[model samples]
Target: MDKRYVRAAVIALMLAGLTLHGGIASAQQKRDTIRIGFVTFLSGPAAGPFGVPARMAAEAVVEQLNAGKAPAPYDTKGFGGTPIELVVIDEAGGTTKQVSEFRNLVSRQNVDYVIGYISSGDCLAIAPVAEEMKKVTVLFDCGTPRVFEEASYKYVFRTRPHATMDAVAAALYLLEQKSGVKSYGGINQNYAWGQDSWHDFDLAMKTLKPDARVTTSQMPKFGSGQYGAEISALIQSGSEVIHSSLWGGDLEAFMMQSVPRGLFRKSQLVLVAGEPYLHRLGANMPDGTIVGARGTHGVFAPDSNLNTWLKTIYKAKAGHDPNYPAYVATLAFLGLKTAFEKAKLEQASSLKPSDDALIATFEGLSFDSPSGRATMSLGKGHQAVMGTAYGTTKLVNGKVTVTNVKHYPAERVTPPNGISSPDWIKGGMKPGK
Candidate 1:
């Protein structure tokens, strides 16, 4: 009787072990595709110049990733061997609409991650929503410092530098090039992005060039192409250097109007964000115009394998050279790829990344980008910083090119930990200090 009972028990135990092993194997085999939501200005004032090229680059990169043809570190198949699916969303709608769209991407679309935003107001409005929704999000282009300064969020990050870096770099370029120019004039768009950029540039001017004075300032409405009145005032005020942070269609419109009106002939123009429009404006864009590309992006980027690969592919697909937006979009997507791979390694799982895992992996992470190495700060805040590039625009053989290009290290352009950008400038922080 004892022998028979032992045999029966052994058989039951063997069957239980087999069932458990099969369950675990099945769970491991069932891998879901990684879904991502990409939002950008696909159909608005920013569409033609900024968002369209960004979307084109996004599509090409996703395709390359899916094909397992991307560069090293991101060279593996789509998001750590799991195929990636992308959903594109337009960011033309105002702030309220963007908030709704971001929620929809998380709740309805069930996106594992979301990226892209060009409008600073949209970035500010959506950051809190992303936090409340507990969705992993990235802002590719918005530059307002308020995203992290005004409030903090665990689930959101910006893979590009803020507006302050752009302004600071612009001011440094101006002073380095034309130190004798003592008068500065501002003509930023009337919006969060424009206002913040103007403030930062003004502060930088005062900090670096204490003797310089702002002769006149204009807060033109965003998308308001009519700048005749503002141009008139700028000319009348006798400004030696006119600092502007306008971008996309607005930047293009200003360049077009000002060129015809001889505004460029009167004063030295410093455009904080002027790369994207260079392709469209070509020779019309005045030579020697000081321009900043937010970071070491686009035309100002140094030669590297990653930059060359992205530019080649993007140009082939879009039929034009990639711009600043494309570079930032690629950076954000590559950062996500890096984060997903890291999560997979930490969890020892081959499945798609979860929202929490993605966020944890991204915080304080560093990776290579077209612009150089980008670092997400964990000690200060979850903000990504990279080197900045600034230069003057020149027409070379019927093509727009940047001259006197300089790259400012992230430490120089980015503020120190626990200090807001404005305070950092007013406190007399200088590059390389």
Candidate 2:
């Protein structure tokens, strides 16, 4: 045999073996990996307070899941032995831009699961897109009740309670703590989340306390970063009680600007989603400011071994306590893990579970979170119902902390079956009574 011909034959064999090996590796990767697109406000005003911690929680949870070191029900080691690979996307632009980005994530990125959305407008925009594209998605933090109210979906579901719960919890807390507060005022971001929060809070007040009137309503643009005029309007309204659902940097700015203007001292303020700003505001946070996590979260509430573990891990990773955004994100990941495992168990095939399998598993599911139990409504458009916790803020040892905390079950605030929130209120069922 010629030396050149022999050498060429040897090289061809080597190349063939390498190609076979590569094909096997690719197949193994596909079977063992779960790709997730995790979207949150990585930039813009909501980044520092809300998105960053949530992202950190995502990183920590994924690391733990990959290592098979998480707590139970979540101890299954990464979605039933498959590793999680998360691609983080910044939710900065407007609703239209978000819709486009969502499409890109589903079609181009080819992610298995899509999670995270703090903006209500973004949530409303992306739900339909997820359904149209047949993408399985979990809206982790968006609280607008309008998502399910406006449309129905098979592949889209929110893993956290809706915005109406926060408002109802706040109103119930106010009436319980401050029965003398006959007049109230509201200042919320002028968007879907804010508008829905204000409306729900107002309706809750009317149903729970009929004598109480909303004297003034201020709808500041999202991320406006200024609330001096809105503060003045609130003050002039002579409201004995004030309500706000602002979160992230907007909430911080409002509190800072309002404190100097004596807004906090003048009226009792209730913040529907305020836990994110607690550490940032610290002593600057007004004493007696009634606030709630969108659900049971933050350092003061969610007193459990799971929450303790979460706080310890989150503080070690991000050098701070875990807040509502972080808690909700963690819960969302756990829910995903549960769904994937359940889907795997229910299916007959040994092959990897499909997106439809995951969706079916997620619908009408119940799982344990760090805070507590969370359930997805079986026939109610896949809406989630989680308990919420409220408390009063105080400067304790120069740190902002909540005390006198209370928990409201999901059924307390959630609208009845087949009834809108406004109609439920108009129907004269006083929540939390």
Candidate 3:
């Protein structure tokens, strides 16, 4: 052969070698580990009381996934494969800090999916950003109704029940369970979580008991001490039942202060998100007080095999009873995994599986959570339609425990569409004089 022909042959062989190596690299990339951004209030007053439990749950779920433990019934992997590794971030600061950290996580760290957010304000702040960035954000604990009120984002999803759901459940339980309880009062923090919860609860009470009266409504600054004035006002209001959305340190302080002032003993007291306070308050909590987790309680100890297993694992890991926040993180991971697997199964030639596709799969998706079954709405708002647990607090084995747990379906409590919460409350349901 001529020299030119020999040179061409050598070049072709080198090109062929490059193509083979490239194929191997592409295969490796396909099997690359997935990265999930786990963000939450990891420091400050919220950490030990509420945020730390969430973080631990996230860590525990991730550990189980890596170990190939059976994912919850809602798991998308059909009970196989390791889940994506979580990239944790401390959202200890306020909303501004959360937005900055979220941007960094997505733009710089390049996380595949995001989970965690205990504060409703932080959730609302991050929702739009998550939409703009086109990342799948599973809000683990942000329950404020405003987060999904008017948003048209397809990527934002909440794995836990919304604030309205909690309020409605509380209202219904009061009406059905506590007959002859005529008047209602509220004491909530002034922020989004508190305001929304109070308004929603009011609406629910009005719907159930048209003559139910709201004697007093108070909003204290978030994390403020000295509830002396609020407690004095509540005592004077002559309300038979008082519902409060206070949590974290605020809750601890309120209970410590109010108990001594005889606020709870005066009448029926309902403490929303009360599970976190049980361990903190211990036997000091007032018995016969109505309290339950905001959306779900890990202490219910449902007879399901999954629940038993989770309780055992959680107890072994955390050395205490797991609260609702832990389940929030676990549910988030379950939601993402389900969505991703569904997207993969439904892959088409033109529409390959991507983050957007995974998000779309969340609609109408039902999964068995630590709390019973949870389903997502298909409309603009991707809120989880899950069950709520209700019960009165009791001292068991020298510990505060919420007993006589009754599961309430979400549909029965949530306000009907097109009605504002305030209007719903004011229309009727005045306490009988």
The whole-model lDDT of each prediction reads: 0.84, 0.82, 0.75
lDDT tens readout by residue for model 2, 1-433:
6899999999999999988775654455444578899999988877887888899999998998889888776877777877888989999998988888888676666677899798887988888888889988899988777788767888888888777778888888888898888899999999877888888888888878888887999999988998888999998998998888887778878888988888877799988877778878887788999988888877544567677778878989998788888988998998888888888987746544787887887888998878788888723638788778789988989988788888887788777556677787667654432
lDDT of 1 at 25: 45
Q: Against the hidden reference, what TM-scores do the models get?
A: 0.89, 0.88, 0.84
lDDT of 1 by residue, 343-413 (tens): 88877664766667777888888999877888887224478888787899889999988889887778877
TM-score of 3: 0.84
Residue 414 shift from truth in candidate 1, angstroms? 1.5
Off by over 4 Å in 2: 1-31, 348-351, 378-381, 430-433
Selected candidate, larger lDDT, 1 vs 3: 1
Off by over 4 Å in 3: 1-31, 71-83, 346-352, 416-433
Q: Summarize candidate 3's per-residue lDDT along 316-394 as a digit string, tens digits.
A: 7999767888877777877767766677776644222676667667776877766676788523447777767788888
Query: Clashing residue pairs, candidate 2?
Result: 143-163
**Clash pairs (backbone) in predicted model 3:** 210-429, 211-430, 212-429, 212-430, 212-431, 213-430, 213-431
